[model samples]
Target: MPVNRRITLAARPVGHPQESDFALDEVDVSSPEAGEVLVRVLWTSVDPYQRGRMSEAKSYAPSLQVGDVITAQSVGHVVESNDRRFSVGDLAVGQLGWQEYATARAGTVRPVPEELDPQTLALHAVGMTGLTAYFGLFDVGKPRAGDTVVVSCAAGAVGQIAGQLAKIAGCRAVGIAGGPEKARDLIELYGYDAAIDYKNDGVAEALRGERVDVYFDNVGGEISQAVHRRLNLGARIVICGQVSQYNAERPELSFHPGLLIMFRARMEGFLVFDYAHRYDEAARKLAHWVASGKIRWREHVTDGLENAPRAFIGMLNGENRGKALVKVAERAE
Candidate 1:
């Protein structure tokens, strides 16, 4: 039997998370029961949303209690299987948390398609992150050809994909990121027409004279307010993850109802889980785009399962360039 090490919440984070907030523990690895499979986790994702779960504040999902395993989207090899759907060597991806080994019912994990080169892509692009960008932009933002689409956190996981998707839609994509390097990557790597470095160049100054038709806002703060002032008539704002406010103990309140009224704009918030039934539909299109070189992504991976906490903290602090993942094991034994 292999050692099963997991990262658990040692304390509820007050503001930005600290390494002391997490604890490492070794648990007994359980064997697969009927209709279940034991997975050897290879890659586990560390996303911004997990920050909300670390706090006691109420939100979309139940908060994580102290001592609970940090929730993560993981891709792993099925080492032991009791279900007919999965074999001992098959690969699967799902909410397997931050652990080296996990035992889940067969239905909880979807088998990775053989064609997907480097199965770790299942943790981000063409998975939940890509789906978030797809639904939020097309369904909520409703971008049209020739529209100026603006995305916040453009160098991050969902932001990069959204920017590319906007380009694919024949819209002019503008991305806002924290630093100059990230801003450069937005245009050179992610296909954004223009990039705004919010840290150096003010959002209002950078967006001057630009009529934003679609605002895919991932960071809601002063930056969003600046974009609101530039909304074109009937502009749409898709409220995705609020990376800026995720770690705040008391989130700042700000609103622009007057701007919405004047521009006749619409602001909507959506959860990727709401579109769960149509996942395969989105996946097919995203896979096609990725295969055709229409979409590209990068990963900022941390080595070792014990570093999952540090990786999660880094992601929340905007230290990661693209998708943040923790490598648990190289491969299944």
Candidate 2:
């Protein structure tokens, strides 16, 4: 049996996750039983949403208990299979957590499309992140052509794709991110019409006297409040990940009720998993956009599974440019 290394939640984090909150453990891998497959994880995603799971808080998803393997989406290849749906050496993606090996029933994991090169993309664009942006923007945000769509945390994995999708819908894309370099990437790389560096350039000042038709809010707090004040009539606000509030023990109170009434804006929060039946619809479109160069993506990959804690911490601190991932093992050659 192979020794499987995994990261487990050691303690609930205070404000921000510390390295001590996670523990690395090694265990013997177990073979798959009937209707299951054993996978050697290649790429693991470290998203801001994972921060919410680290704490015992009421959330859309259940909080992770102490000693549980940190929740994550992973891309891997099946090494052994007891299910006809999957065969040895097939690529798969699922909520496989932070581990070198994982066992799952075939129904729980999806086969990776063979055209998706660098299989790591299954954990980033053309995968969950892309689907999140696709459903959140199109289904919830309901952006219209010629509208101005503003996205917070604009340089993040979902944020980057959301901004581009907004542009593809013929909306004027505006992005708000921290740091000058990220702001530049929002415009030059992600193709946002305008980029605001909230850390340096004031968000309110940059967006002053502007009318926002849609807001794809990724980080909620004062930044969202600033955008709220400038909403155009009948604006739509898609409540995506609230990265800024994830670390807080108590929710950061903001968002005046009057803004919604004044703007007649629709604010909706959705989970990508809720659209499971339509995942193939979104994936096919995202894959086409990516292949045709309509969408661009980047990955900030931390080298080893042992460094997952560091990568998660860095990602929470806005240190990563795009999708933050842990490269657990090399892809089978």
Clashes of 2: 0
Clashing pairs in 2: none
Against the true structure, what is each candidate's TM-score?
A: 0.97, 0.98
User: In terms of lDDT, which candidate is strongest?
Assistant: 2
With a 3 Å backbone cut-off (N, CA, C), the pairs that clash in candidate 1 are: none
> How would you encode candidate 1's per-residue C-alpha lDDT over 1-333 as one tens digit per residue?
887999999999878889999999998997999999999999999998898888878789999999999998999999999999999889999999998899999998988897997777787788889999999999999989999999999999999999999999999999999988898899888889999999999899889979999999999988888998899999999999788888776777545688888999898999999998898899889988998999999999899988988888888878998899898888745
lDDT of 1 at 251: 77
Q: Give me the runs in candidate 1 sitting further than 4 Å from their true place.
A: none
Cα TM-score of candidate 2: 0.98
Candidate achieving the largest TM-score: 2
